[model samples]
Target: MKNEIRVIGGRFRSRKLRFPDAPGLRPTPDRVRETLFNWLRNDIEGARCLDLYAGSGALGFEAASRGASKVVQVEQDAAVCRALERNRALLNAEAVEIVQVEVRRFLAGEGQPFDLVFLDPPFRQGLVVPCCGALEENGWLSSSAKIYLEAEREFRLDGLPLNWRPLRGGKAGEVGYHLCERTFFR
Candidate 1:
């Protein structure tokens, strides 16, 4: 994410923070971030947010900026985690926590629930299904939690766990947001 840090839409607009040139770091696009934050603006405030595969801490820091009570980020890549930490500090977002761990392991180890969880694994990784299931088993999500899932537009989600239901999705260039909510099965 060598590109300059750009705030989607808020007080930090046009502010360029340091974004290291790293391969594992693909910051979510501003247009998509803007739409996501807009859709979540009301609920995001005061929410306990979790960001999985938080490369550059974009989503997590954004949550903090928008008034989330606390934001926890998980990223497996060491360099990416470092970048995330730097970005968090640059944004002056002290309410964010960055944990260097694989998405699966973190979900498997989670001991508490979050109000909102953002899961944006790399493209073609097929992480959503197992991650959600692991989250449930590990007590990482509130029963009423909302999960924002993202993937490549062409990725077919035929095997996702029964708990998730697609809410809103649209392609922005090559990436897509597959917003899903926890739903009852049986």
Candidate 2:
């Protein structure tokens, strides 16, 4: 079976993207995305972005539609990657790149700093801390980057980098979303 999600803002607003139904594949909801982008209005234009665990490529595509210079979507699943590719073609998203690799493996390679990152790993996998650490330690973030995190409402931000200052947060039912800014780098 396949599921569909809509891009809620930017040039691709109202476009429908289809994806295969897979375990742990949850696309960020429309309202949540709207709020996140609103919070990033001043920062997103022409920014470089990384979308880890890119499941349905919702956030990444939205960023591209909104004028991000480049958007890398990292997904471990081949089927999902194919769907993302199709969507990229459908939207003529020249700035979006789909990387078919595990998030950690991708993060382990030489890093290119990104101005914004979306880290929405599978729920209940305890991946947030390690991935967050890899992103910082591996130098995948620009000095003043902003990161968007989505997880279960009960999930805490303990163990995250001390410089990741929370800028905004909100909740919708079982999910909690936050935007954090990476402060001065050593």
Q: Considering every candidate listed, which one attains the maximal TM-score?
A: 2
Global lDDT of each candidate: 0.77, 0.94
Decoy 2 TM-score against native:
0.98
Q: In candidate 2, which residue pairs clash?
A: none
How do the residues 96-126 of candidate 1 rate in per-residue lDDT, one tens digit apiece? Answer: 8989987887776736978899988888777
Give candidate 1's whole-model lDDT.
0.77
Off by over 4 Å in 2: none
- lDDT over C-alpha atoms for residue 165 of model 2: 97
lDDT of 2 by residue, 1-186 (tens): 349999988999899999988889988988899999999999989999999999999999999999999999999999999999999999999999999999999999999999999999999899999999999999999999999999998988889999999999989988899999999895
CA RMSD per model (angstroms): 2.1, 1.1
TM-score of 1: 0.89
Question: What local lDDT score does residue 20 receive in model 1, on the 0 to 100 scale?
Answer: 60
